[model samples]
Target: MQTEHSFTLVVAYVDDLLVTSSDSTVITILKTALNSAFTITDLGALKYFLGIEVSRSDFVQQLSQFLSEPRAPHWSAAVHVLRYLKGTINFGLFYPANSGLSLEAFSDADWGTCIDSTRSLTGYCVFMGNSLISWKTQK
Candidate 1:
């Protein structure tokens, strides 16, 4: 409800309660009311949002360059990427079901940073609102 006096909105997302109000007192009052009804913990101020974790693409891309005559070091680097991915599996990209029609695109290039070919290792991701639609990395 929107009113000149005050308006508060509470959104529940996967065990998280997001509360926002036009008035600060309304926020406190709402929190107190919710806390009394159900046990809740207030985590203050958003800090670091864990985004994608990736080693430099050129380094990872290099490992696959010489496919016919791949050396031991190349194999080691490939294994490293696998290990890193496994370690950060819990923090992988999340695409929620509900999304809007906001198209967001991001692209990055290492600018001829490939160890062997010296070609640009480029990558891009497209998102519709908060949902990731397509992504790619190439040399």
Candidate 2:
């Protein structure tokens, strides 16, 4: 359905329906129309859907999380990650409006650094126009 500010699209699969729109008003209208024809319940704003947590703010839309059962080591690792995130809560990548569209990357590896596995640890970051778009580290 079309609205002045946005267009709404509904994708139906089995008994589930995902309604999407850029404008909240359009979404509201679509929900009302659907309710009139079918017994559908609004689940409110999207948060944790399936296995992912959806978070949005004025400058960012973040999808986070994976399904995992924590073991003892995993629990301690999770706490460490939480502490790191808390310490860098305000840190983020920023791109200026006039930034050039350029791609850059940096990577490094320490051969045989992991004593237990005798495997190297490697990490890298990819940037697009001065904005870091992807990063990863692993053994």
User: Which candidate number maximizes TM-score?
Assistant: 1
The residue ranges of model 1 lying beyond 4 angstroms of the native Cα positions read 46-108, 112-139
* lDDT digits (tens) for residues 1-139 of candidate 2: 7757677788676777778886777788778998999999888876754323566664112112222454666566667778888999999768798876787889999899798999999999987777777789999
Error of 2 at 16 (Å): 2.0
Checking candidate 2 for backbone clashes, the offending pairs are: none
Best by lDDT: 1
* TM-score of model number 1: 0.39
Candidate 1 global lDDT:
0.75
For candidate 2, the TM-score is: 0.37
Lowest-sum lDDT 10-residue window in model 1: 47-56
lDDT of model number 2: 0.74
What tens digits encode model 1's per-residue C-alpha lDDT throughout 29-58? 888998999999987543322233333336
Clashes of each: 0, 0
